[model samples]
Target: MKTKIILFLTTVLLSINITDRGSASSNYFEADVIIYGGTSAAVTAAVKVARTGQSVIMVSPDIHLGGLSSGGLGFTDTGNKEVIGGLSREFYQRVYEYYQQDETWQWQDRSEYGNRGQGTTALDEEFGTMWIFEPHIAEQVFEDFINDEGITVLRDEWLDRKDGVVTEDGRIVSFETLSGKRFKGKMFIDATYEGDLMAAAGVSYHVGRESNDTYDEEWNGVQTGVYHHNHFFPPDGPHIDPYVSPGDPSSGIIGGVSVAPPGEKGSGDHRVQAYCFRMCLSDHPDNKVPFPKPDNYEPSQYILLLRLFESGWHERNNFFTKYDEIPNRKTDTNNHGPVSTDYMGMNYDYPEASYERREQIIQEHEDYQKGMMYFLANDPRVPREIQNEVKRWGLAKDEFTDNGNWPHQLYIREARRMIGDFVMTEHEVLGNREVPKSIGMGSYTLDSHNVQRYITPEGYVQNEGDIGVSPDQPYEIAYGSLIPKKDEIQNLLVPVAMSASHIAFGSIRMEPVFMVLGHSAAAAAVLAIREGQAVQDVNYNDLRNDLEADGQVLEYSD
Candidate 1:
């Protein structure tokens, strides 16, 4: 009887913790705020929580810290720099400070690199910020932020999406990970690009483009004929056939080109935009690792590209157009042209796929991209001049040191967007409607990459769903978009995957804007905890005040 009592007491103590604040054991962790993600927004949100003298735990699936910001996307897509304030601007300022040191520029001298950017200079001396930098530097800055705040971060901890969340009366009490580790907190923030937690919590969300009629907007759904960027096969330039053997229908459709008919202009579909790695490449001989052929390289995949070159598209000499140069003689190479790095139609299932399935999809993308590079650089079918230029560039030896010096995070351009109290549409983005309860501002063009590459009725291959509509001005993002319907979840905030129409999210999904929303979401979470109110019930005026106090730009004047 004595032994039984001692054993029972020990088991009880290990299972439960009783304290005003939270506690941490081998299987359980408790904190005032729990953030799930490793994106730029996740880092900013964690910093905000820790700055308010609260206990915060970051449950991240990424082994590295920053998602796209530090994952080889050094060339920032800052549409308007004025609207990017708070921690987003602070991140750029740190980049500037790091570059100011003489030793920071290694392969290339500071004066040797051109200071170019999207709409502003890369190195802004007056603003004390730098928009362009190396991948490792951005990762270091994120690490420094975590270290400065003394925040607790658990890396590579994936959420158990099957049955991990414990909710009572619309509040999330705790969520367990795949390793049986559970996290309990007063407030939660879903800063992931995929919105995994938001979906697992049974919150309503949308996976694909909503019909324009669904949101009463003009650009929400399928856009087959409208080609805003130079990412399409020019009708007059090249009539590249989609068939494997030129014009033979029995030869079957070539790889990367779909056979389905392009859907109606205004109709909705279950398709998603393409995804690719924002590769960091170096031209410097000492720091460049030549592109290697993937073990499962498929030469047949390049047949379409070879046909495009054969049909005279190679005369443009635009293969390196998107190789935007950053510091240290490296480049943040992104997708360009009709058939580039953007793996079209390959990621439609990634948003809702299981962990093992998502891994397979990711591997497919990696193999395709690696093989494409090797084909371009070494394959005899490639134009000689193009192959020579491709051979000059290779993966940066200093970036993404692990995983064979390749970026660990894929550019998940768009994913599961939460359907919450408010949904931002094109009317709000184009300044036709006023947004209520501003939490942040976004100024990027309504941009969506090519969603599919299909055979046109004319038997030629063409890309569809690429859009780039500029906003009338910097627009406010509503606070209501961050929270689920008041009845669904009371203590959770989703800033990265906030409620927005497909067109609206195209503009609102910039990295700087995400950090702004993240800071605002954390502010709201902190306020709700202090007032003992639901996240949806937090006063907008108080949230605005808190955001402004934290240097977040919630409104635009010019």
Candidate 2:
């Protein structure tokens, strides 16, 4: 066992080349625009920069090209598809074109697939866009974009967050990666969900929820009793005890129940929302790999789930409610009920954690979610009906081929949001206040998953911070929200973790919107490069003209 462990460690060290000092042979790179993420936004931004006849380099931590969009979140959450435009819409159009050929349907016929999205057609012929797709197909589209533009992508290159950035009078000159390779650029865009580069560059940012008083919004802070969806304990069901021994105080709380007080209502805290992998599941016998038992699986950790089953969860049909269908008879399975995929209260430090620490957190989430599935499908304690239903699904064989058929990216719903020149609040998202300098539009309902699970005052298990609030209409996202304050950073733009209050971010953090902001951010970066100005100093008129000329939808009308 010791020999095997040492061999594995040595293999990993050599593969990463931790000892290499990054000699001049492959140490230095220069680009007109430097992107520091592998998200859908990063692809669009790179495409935009390349289309503008500028050199761009993508320094990505993950080997994958697209983030959640291609990471098992194939069922696109597009609210009002008409407002999605530019490279974002072009991406969907490419998906539409891919499915036009009969060869694209391998496991199921095209006619058998549902053409419905979030109240819209999944395959919108009129707009020439296809919303729902498979993980591999979305990734192929992003790769096609990169190949078409000749963008340089450095995959699996992590930024040295502690000492990577080299700033000169508020302008970033270069940033070093973990492998010691230095990349220099005239302008940079932090397109990561974690905002790693942005945070490393001394940019102002915020994590977790803010008090409702800070933003004067109804849905910005800790919410204890607000149940927007069916992700809560059923009110009519018998209360399940949170302790290991029912009606006993000394037995201690179960695995997921938080011991800390859930803060006063409407107050802020350091608790981040839950994180989970959006599992890509398949029911096809040839394409499915049965859920495997985790090495460190603990059945006692899921005792609450057993109690949930006893409290009528199966009769309520809650287990499989969020097993949303995608192409080829696959599923983009997300959190559904009181006890599901989400690893609540487990990712609060992820935003600012070290790379090694983040890896541990990711592995913990993977184990918990995968173990939950295994428990449900194989454990004798689970209801037979649920076990039978869960047994029908498994990991998709054709997806994430290199990563044990698991997703390459975790669904980081919210993370480090930059506190930039302009802060978007719910007032702007709900259309109560007019936003200036429109760069893009987001129409999705304000949504957030559960943050913490704890025993209620009545001694029953309950979840907190799940929110779903709809906006009156589609609203504009200001360009100022993407760039940092002029005094703080001169040439950096953050699109994925753009400036916004918590509730406002919930609406803007969608993949399509991230692509929209990425395209706009790249255009602004190019303008900044050409004009020899700070990102904040770029003229709004020129930025708007550039975006509109590229067919970006900046405004919506009824």
Model 1 regions lying over 4 Å from their true place = 1-24
Lowest lDDT sum, 10 consecutive residues, model 1, at: 14-23
In model 2, where do residues sit more than 4 Å from their true spots?
Answer: 1-25
The true-versus-predicted C-alpha distance at residue 385 of model 2, in Å, is 1.4
Residue range 1-558, candidate 1, lDDT tens digits: 999998788556534432224554567788889999999999999999989988788999998998999998999999899989999899999999999999999998889989998789999999999999999999999999998986778889999998999888999999999998899999999999999999999999998899888988888788878889988999665588888788899999899998888788878888888999999999999999999889999999988888888877768757789999999999999999888899999999999999999999889999999999999999998989999999999999988988788999999999999999999999899889999999999999998999999887778889988999998789999999999998999999999999998889989998889889888899999999999999988988998888898888888986
Error of 1 at 129 (Å): 0.4
RMSD of each: 5.2, 5.7
Error of model 2, residue 188, in angstroms: 0.4
Give the per-residue Cα lDDT of candidate 1 at 76: 95
